[model samples]
Target: MAEWWRGSVTYQVYPRSFQDSNGDGIGDLVGITARLPHLAALGVDAVWLSPIFKSPMADMGYDVSDYTDVDPLFGDLAAFDAMVAQAHALGLKVIIDQVISHSSDQHAFFRESRQSRDNPRADWYVWADANPDGSPPTNWLSVFGGSAWEWDARRRQYYLHNFLPSQPDFNFHNPAVQDWALEVLRFWLERGVDGFRLDTVNYYFHDDQLRSNGPMPTRDNRPPVNPYDLQDHVFSKSRPENTGWLERMRALTDEYPDRTMVGEVGDAAWRNVAIMAEYTQPGRLHMAYSFDMLGPEFTAGHFREKIEGFFAGAPDGWPMWAFSNHDVIRHASRWASHGAPDAVAKLASAMLLSFEGSVCLYQGEEAGQVETEVLFEELTDPPGIRFWPDYKGRDGCRTPMVWDASEHGGFSEVKPWLPVKAPQLARNVAAQDGVPGSVLEFYREMLAFRRMTPALQVGRTRFFDLPEPVLGFARGDGLACVFNLSARPVVLTATGALIDGAPCHAAHLDAGRLLLGANGFAFLRPDGGLGLSAG
Candidate 1:
């Protein structure tokens, strides 16, 4: 199909936890290359490998030390080339994570920028003078916890870091910085890659005035786990200048044949979709995703607003949606209270795949992988360690993939970097292979169905005004999907032909109505044009 990514399904592989071929308790490019067939078997159109770039591992590779080289831990450039070749051979497009919003303080660019102010690269980073009282230049808070500004005595200036202190934010306001960033993108594009999964894409720009973010009034009585949430974060990120950089990125991508860019728009739920809509408009990013659906809220209105709102704001824009990723808690575990873990996974999968945009399936989500429980001592994430019992960090979700019933779940010969627990191990691929009604097989079935269906892919969506617990919507003119979001069974009118998922599966179609079991869902082909009422 033309513009394969328009409605393509992407499988996100967390390389460090996917598979370890060298048996150093870490996954590498060779491991990912070997697993290309697994992704092919899952029927995904693309493979998005989370940062395999050279990094100091400050934020699990989000802190990049070198832009143009592969990390020795993941393997050399040869391994990356082999992985790309294998993915292309398997009919899967390749998307690499671009964490250029910030770089490791040890990076050559940041190192020189941190030197005395007269250096050539001094303005390459977001440096500023401290307040007269010796405080930070601004009250902008870091997502990791404290002030976003980290003071460097060498330059006698404060540097911006929306993330960790070791990962300094780049000065996108500088034309040289933007040019260097474009060259970095060119290096990867010349490597035969298909697209980019831009990490913290909105964090690429900050207010040039170094203004303070206003206080955000909390709607609840209880306080948040981190103080960063106390502020509105307007000045810290989501600056308007980001649009120019996005346009630059999109222009660079257009130079390459069939290349695309999907950015991660991390913002408040009330506005992230609008930001995503804005960024993905015609001359900017080809697609964008937000933390809206990745959060704990799994209501009908929430899903409708995110999917519909994005299109409502930018009709020409596209969205790449997901329920689980390396950064957040696995949706299977996060939404377990709604139904059985497997049921929730299947329901979420159907709902996510049936939407009117591209979809990303995180590693281990197919087998209904739940988040692992990492003890305080086993944690490697900085925020998790700093916050303790309150926030266990992302280590749980980033645990090594479980492939079998053997010890270590066939992920590695030696112990993995993150421990694989019983819950995760129990949902192994070996146990679910070819099993009828198994979560793994169901994923295969859903992916196969999604691939074969036209309306579900690159289609116009109109949501139904059905009541709570029943999320009814039509995709294109022919396909209609209904999902039961609750634990108890419910019945609704069947406005279309019963084609898939009934009786023994997610739901059942009776005489003229549909009876949806706990967390059940169904796909129907409307008899005529889907003229459903507005949601």
Candidate 2:
């Protein structure tokens, strides 16, 4: 690729909920193809689809049975080809999600591997002998609840699973496993995919010794509902050998024209950004992102640290930033106390687009979509059900997209996989499609502004020393981006002429000061000799 992703915007489409054309209460490839116009009109540079491979729906398709074929639930290989063709026709790059770290227990490779100790594929997955007392070989814990090691009755041994028991971690130490992964990428490259989004990219390897993970330091009084967050996780993941496997993946992607890859680095907040930096070093992944911006922290220092942390760790590496995705609660709902729903949504868009890297926008975000309140009876996500009231799981964020104000929000004719409530459905596309001051329109305008501003796209970011709740930064040379992170108005003293900003009650310039309304923001170009400070 010619560095197209450096400043591009990608919109994620959760295929299971984007639209259901067949009315089977599930979305398909054909539905996505029909909705291509929505993405094209939204002004995003590319479209990223969640997993569509043959899966048993374990961990919501993160557990794949066939790596090279599309699930009939999504559509056949032909349907995938058609979707790619349509996306390309609309001038959009297509990036598909790839789960290479593990495979479903029902996968042919894993099935045969577990049948016998000496089978040809027995070494394909991480398998170990139990202790004298028949306990697990190691103390690793699954990202889901319970032990990471599962007992196999046939082989009388324990197999490691970083996720659910149905999802077995691949043995990256085995060279054959690496070769097969590359082949799988090659199969998709031949089919004309623009790139791949590697799921749980850093969880590809484990310590050879299979040593136990140590406890992580706690800094709070609140107890943790999930014990997975209580460990150092040094031996279980973030292995040094993952670099070699990433190189192999990069080399394979380099074989095709204009191909790219973005890996998801899931780790401790302290190390995830650094790991993402390492993964995107020379001869590896094109770009990498973490859960830093996708979490509950929304502060000036938090955003600055993450953006500057990636560059500080590896000056030459590239990082992709996102505020929401299929995982975590939507930012609007997560940070609800900061400001009004619409103001917070629009302000977030301006900040994300103004950041100095590639960006990804989740589905329904353009409509200012909030997380749905999924009841226990309607929960389908594994983690949500395992830890019921304490953690409702990701089903709230994975609900279907809202396209119109009509019943089901134009997502499907039959009852969809997830419920579409009135609060979120009220913000549908049909209502805000062409209306000015709407979140959808604001996003369209903000994206257009980012495209014309080279400084915002690929600029050196430097923060202004403003007080808390007021964020200020410089993109390139003259573009000054500022935002009020609180619900109350804030003022800053600056001797600069008001040059440019998105049309909104977000902010304004006065005699010698900048007055920002609640959740207000502005983009300014200053004259010579300009200084900014809190008023």
The models' CA-based lDDT, in order, is: 0.88, 0.90
Relative to the true structure, candidate 2 has a C-alpha RMSD (angstroms) of 1.3
| lDDT of model number 1 | 0.88
Q: Model 1, which residues run further than 4 Å from truth?
A: 500-506, 528-535
Q: Model 2 reaches what TM-score against the true structure? A: 0.98
Off by over 4 Å in 2: 501-504, 528-535
lDDT of 1 by residue, 124-206 (tens): 88999999999999999999999899999998989999989999999999999899989999999999999999999999889
TM-score of each: 0.97, 0.98
Question: What is the number of residue pairs that collide in model 2?
Answer: 1
Task: Give the clashing residue pairs of candidate 2, or none.
Answer: 506-520
Worst 10 residues of 1 by lDDT: 526-535
For candidate 1, report its TM-score: 0.97
